[model samples]
Target: MRGPAAPPPQPGWALKAATAVVYAAILAWSVFSRGPEGLQAVAMLALGYAVILGLIVFAALAFFSLWRRFRTPRNRARVMLGLGVFLLAAVVPPFAEHNDDNRQRDIANAEIRKAIDTLRQQAAGGSGAPEDVPAIDPAPRASGPYGEMERVMKTVAGARLAQHRAYLQELQEIGLPRLFDARRLARDTGLIESRLILEQAERLVPGYRRQSLDVLNGMPALVRSLTIADAEKDKILAALQTSNAASNAKLTRLWDLESQILREFGQMITLLDDNRQYWYADKNELMFGRDGDLRRFRQHQESVSRMVGEQEQLGVQSLAAVPQAPLR
Candidate 1:
């Protein structure tokens, strides 16, 4: 007996509205969280959602077919509800997690940028220990692939900054004054100090260069430690490569500048010795001859002064080359 042919299935306006709101909210949050830079991520997310949405639509058509196959209205409603719940469970969690991962990556990149900025500032300014610098604000260190890389990057940054700080201090403290003491051929304490500092810097610079080279060389292996998606990994690796090249170039310039200073110091010492025969130390006066010792002395002084100016200019250029954002 057909007991009042079953009522036609009604559209569930409430469920449809709720589903629209959920999808809209996720899309909105994704754009908002990533800013302008996140358009690619947002597009990827939208594509994933669209695929899921299409599957849901197909499932709805299947559910309609099942509705006709079923005998009772009660059975149809149960089947629809169960399928809807299953689809919701499958679709929502992954997108939510994708959103979460986006937020986390942004946070980590910001921290890394901040840390690199601090390093750039320190190296450019070339003053004070790391303690004198502002402390990095604390945040949850990202776990997984980024965690190890982040730590190592910051460590390398710190080492570079420390080396520059030490170099500047020694240069100002001991290098410049005796560097220009071209008239002092005596065994003075200041000259001794400068000589010792020059030898120390010469010894330390190669070590510093070696350390930097090691860091650059090991970067490929370090990148391999990350277990992120291939696309993401390649992006990070590119930035790291740029950063390494810049660091290496700057380090080489610094080494050259130091070498120039050391070489000038040695030349200045030689000039003092060569001109010592022309000076009467007791009278603080010069003995002149037709041999052109006086002319050579004047020329040496001018050359030393010009070299000093050159060093100053090189230092300025080196500082200017420092990246405002190293990791970018």
Candidate 2:
């Protein structure tokens, strides 16, 4: 007769313990290592955990199959307990790590929004530009598709800047705020959250600034001619210095506003100038129309505004010599 069935094989406690240790070591190592390529590190950890999870799943299946052979209640209970531990050890960490990554990305997105809002307020305050307008320098004609396009775009952007600058000058001349019931809102740029707004401003600013260089252009010669016999010019100048129906002060704020817009406008010009191809439309036909006479005209226009205070005083001095006109 056959001897008593061989005693059931003992559970592989050593293998399970070693597996637990290995899994713990890999998780711990992946969690701790930080490096220059942070995204790469995160990706690597994700991959590592995925591999570890796969291995644990396979191992747990093997353990259950082998342990089920035993008929004793105590042995069966022990097998179930080991399975619980293995499942818990393998699944918990990857879930926690994924949640943490998502949370961080959300926080970063929020901060970026705050930064953009601040930028917007500063731009709209109408306080003028960040710095003095630089003298316009001619750039070499761009070649190739990209270069040509950039140049053309710069030209277009520059043209737009000039038009806005002219509009502002006209506003200052007749006085937009001074004449019209103009209202202005200078909300804080810190509140601007959108990147699209910032990008739009970036694209528009340089061209706006480039065109403004001539707002004051040829204005002096005309002012000199117009003010000669007409005392109204001087009066208009004085009205500009003080508040009227338009501006509350001589500083129309448009000057500063234009100045501010120009800063960005100037930048676009530089960017377009640098990348000519983006601006270029065709080989024979260029992007924007070029004008150099504008450069000289702006010089005099600025000089006129700067001397307005002294010019006003001179007007007072000259007024004493002229006969007073009769009122109807």
Candidate 3:
């Protein structure tokens, strides 16, 4: 009995420190793997709630058990310290991720401002579209959360610029009425085809489902992108106006006319579609004859055409008055 065997030496301080490090690392990994966003997305789900509640209960029970086992005040304090560490580790990941997203957003905002500034400079220089619309190229390779944001901002700007240029050209050349007429005709043709298909049901084509309006499958949808808010549009317009008030005025008029034209067109189309029951389709041919609704359709078409003509003429005159308009 060598000195009554000094009670087994307590685990070395180094061992205790290592154990703490390992525990903290595991907790961190568990919390981070799901990510803050993922956790929030699932938090309301039944399974998610159960798991979260279970974790809370387990943590509480474990804390109390450890508290009792470590009876001495110093030991009790150490246990409390461990509990604090566990809570800190659990909370750090969510806060860290939230901060990172905010940082990324700030960086994206800076890049957006820089891009918009480039556009302003291009407008001032009159180096429009086909050459440099946005005048700011997206990063050659963009990845990660903020990278995606920058990419989308650049893409929307480019698309909006191209659309603006196209509208400008239409005003100068073919005119809005002609452009609108072509679209209306295309849509009407689709409606006629759909009518014929419905009249014939599955008899017109083999294996065709009566429920499927197959002929209208590729019709253009009437949706506007909402990525750019009104405020952003105002900012862009202000920037352009600063460069060339006359040119920007013309552009603005055309954009306004486009909205009005589309609205009228949609309403007319909806009216025609809703009263399709009054239209008769020739069973053997792709022909549709408007019956009782013929007068209504013609009247509406004439109204739209007249409105569009008036708007187009005004937009065109404005464009003509502006010498060296960036539109060309």
Candidate 4:
């Protein structure tokens, strides 16, 4: 029977206090549920607090203009919408399991560590921790570089090459070691054989090279990256694949070479890091052209890149006529 008095305006601090109480209630429940794991409970509470706080700030700004008392009626609608979104957000992240990012990053790091160990096993004679992947190495041969080179040449020159992109599938299944018979050879064996194999590989593979110290240093990183790449991983595997069984073993040797190169390069970088001032001096000297502990790393990279490109071109030209599947 009486006209309604104007509704009281809600104070900003009151809304914030209510939000804080809701959060505190949620945190208490979490702590009670995880009593023995108090540290974990605390961590969860902190996370929840951050997410909720972010939501509160976001909602406050979003709704301020929408509230009629705060601003205009139109602004009030916008603010209401923002508050709804913020409330929804506050409830979502806590239920998100909190371990998704840590899980994924842990998996990536695990894969990298496994790959490194795999390299060590293969290099040390194919043995190590319970690995899902087997490490295989090339055996050293009595044949000299020239003879090895001839073998590589024959492997490439045989002319009965299969050209198919699906070959990459075969590669992933077999791995780089399967591309060549590694047990029959070692570093010396490949120097000559590598010449031919590399010549062919330079063209046949998409991401590979035998020259350039910088690239040699980066090879393991590339391999590790490939093992973890979300897409185009096949390209990396393909580089390690070969149609010839003997070649597959040899390819494994190539993996060893790459591993050794990376290890050495990392060591070199460490050496540089230890002598930071010396490194800076030498780095600048090389770039500007005066020989003081100079390292021709960049120039070497460009020159080797050009040569590798040419060699790869020659390989593709040589094998272009061969019947094989197209690259994916």
**Per-model CA lDDT versus the true structure:** 0.56, 0.39, 0.46, 0.38
lDDT tens digits, residue span 186-242, model 3: 455545643332233223222221111221121111001323345644543454345
Candidate 2 Cα lDDT to native = 0.39
RMSD of 4: 20.7
TM-score, per-candidate, Cα-based: 0.51, 0.23, 0.31, 0.27
- RMSD each, Å: 8.8, 25.8, 20.8, 20.7
Worst 10 residues of 4 by lDDT: 156-165
**Candidate 2 residue-wise lDDT, 1-328, digit = tens:** 9989977655467655655666565565455533225767777876876687667655655666675554444454355455545555765567556545444434433433332333223323333332311112113132222222223223323332346444445434432222111111112122122223334444554454444333223223333343123564465345333333232122233344434443443443344344433334343333433344334334544654555434334323322111122211
Model 1 agreement with the true structure over 100-185: per-residue lDDT tens digits:
66656555666677677776565444344434655443333765545544555555555555655555565556455344443443
Model 2 off-target regions past 4 Å?
1-14, 25-67, 70-111, 121-328
lDDT of 4 by residue, 47-113 (tens): 8766866676566866564644656433443454445455547754564343333334343344334
Residue-level error in angstroms, candidate 4, position 91: 9.4
- Comparing candidate 1 with candidate 4, which one achieves the higher TM-score? 1
**Worst ten-residue run, lDDT, model 1?**
319-328
lDDT of 2 at 240: 31
TM-score winner between 3 and 4, please give it.
Answer: 3
Root mean square deviation (Cα) for candidate 3: 20.8
Task: Arrange candidates by lDDT, descending.
Answer: 1, 3, 2, 4
- Cα error, residue 213 of model 4, in Å, equals 27
Instruction: Say which prediction, candidate 2 or candidate 4, comes out ahead on TM-score.
Output: 4
Candidate 3, residue 92: how far the Cα is off, in Å:
2.1
Between which residue pairs do clashes occur in model 3? none
